[model samples]
Target: MKISELSRRTGVPVASIKYFLRQELLPAGRATAATLAEYGDEHVQRLRLIKALTALGGLSIAATRNVLAAIDQADSSEGALGAVSYALPVPVAAQSAAGDEEEAEADATAGAEVAELLAALDWQAPGTSPHVQGLTSALKELRRLDARYAPGELAAYARLAESVARLDLERAAGVDDPVALAERAVIVFAICAPVFELLRRLAQEDQVRRRAAGDGAEAASPR
Candidate 1:
């Protein structure tokens, strides 16, 4: 098909498609003449993946490029999974007071707490993981607010996270195509994250209502 046909079929504008081709986000179509080229089904699929990453998954072009490279170079399922994992954005930790000794000490303490928590949970994430940084930052904030999770509570949260991760990996393993699997990983998380949060909020509301009406199992049980 011609570029125009590719653009029409994909619902991507001609200018944008041209830009993608120039950026090498979309591969160049087969040159047919000085000013014309022919695209195929693979181009359509690639364009859809690019749109999903940029438009729906909210990845920047650079990140999208890295993810695409990962897909292209991946030799195994684990390699593809690792590529997507590393390409995903990490949450940046908030900065503290500049050159303040006490603030530095507090930050160090939070880092220690994060390490301890991860150790207790038996998670083997790298020290450089954004999740570790984010958790350390959150722990610092909790200390500032004089609020902290009990060890048992933190452990429970870790267990739940592990279960969710296991389910995600299982689903990813089912896909035969590495590129499609990588795309699915990003799209599934983007779409399901909000839905998961909403379900948690709804469950909280239901619990509150049940307690207020003295109808919950815990509310009805002997105190």
Candidate 2:
């Protein structure tokens, strides 16, 4: 297929496809003539993967390139997952916590709390992990907001997060192709994070309504 056909098939613009080629995000096709190239099904698959990383996964060009390289180099499922997760941009709060001198104490406290939470759950991850660091930042913010969210208060949330993560990993584990698995992980995390937040808010509203209705029913009943 020509570049135009590739664009048509993938719903990507021809110019954008050319740009991907220039950026080395997409590999060059076989040369058919001095000014022509022929793409194959592999190219189609590659384009779709690139689209998923950038569009669905919301990765920048540089990040997408790194992930692509990781996918190509990965020999196993864990390697692919590591590459995908590492290539994701760190949360802004976590980045700020890492650099801000004012956050040092809070970061340390949050780190200790997180360590305790991890030990309680028998989970292992480096303190420097982006996910761990992100959690530290969030815990720090929560502590700043209220004394109610003290060091040990995150255990319940952490347990729920672990349950969700286990389900995600189980689905990924069934995938045989490392590249496909990486793509699935990236897309699922990127899309589902916001979806999860929205669902939480919806559940909160439902709980409030249910409690309000129960109170109304009790008030209307005879003593």
Candidate 3:
């Protein structure tokens, strides 16, 4: 297929496709002429993946390149997953000055709490994982606000996380190609994260409405 055909089929603008080609986000098609090239199905797939990563996943060009490189180099499901995780941006708290002992203590406490939670859950991620560090940072803020979860509550959240992780791994295992698996992971996180949050909010609202109705009924019961 020609580049024009590739762009038309993928609904990606020709200029954007050219930009991707220049940036090496999408591999160059075969050179049939000085100005004409033939693209293949693989090129189409890669272009779509790039579009999803940048447009939906909100990754920058550099980040997308790193993610694609990781996917290309990954030899197994775990490796691909680790690459995706590393590529995904995680919010880290701003560090304090070197002499800020109080800030250092808070960070230490937060890291310890995160370690404890992960240990209790038996999750095997390395301490240096971006997700772990982000969670630790979040826990630090939660602690500062006196809103940290009790152990039991944290355990409940861990169980939910485990369930989601299991489903993700199960789906990823079906794709034999590491690159395709990484693409799937990118799409899943980009598209499903917001959907999951929406579902949770809807469920909470339903539960609250039910509880309010129950409370009203109980108060109306002539005791």
As a whole number from 0 to 100, the lDDT of residue 34 in candidate 3 is 98
Q: Evaluate all candidate structures by whole-model CA lDDT and list the values in order.
A: 0.81, 0.81, 0.82
Best-first order by lDDT: 3, 2, 1
Candidate 2 lDDT by residue in tens digits, 127-192: 878888887877787777654364455677777888888877886878878767877887767777
* TM-score of candidate 3 to 2 decimals: 0.90
Best by TM-score: 3
lDDT of 2 at 63: 89
Query: Each model's TM-score?
Result: 0.87, 0.86, 0.90
Worst 10 residues of 1 by lDDT: 89-98
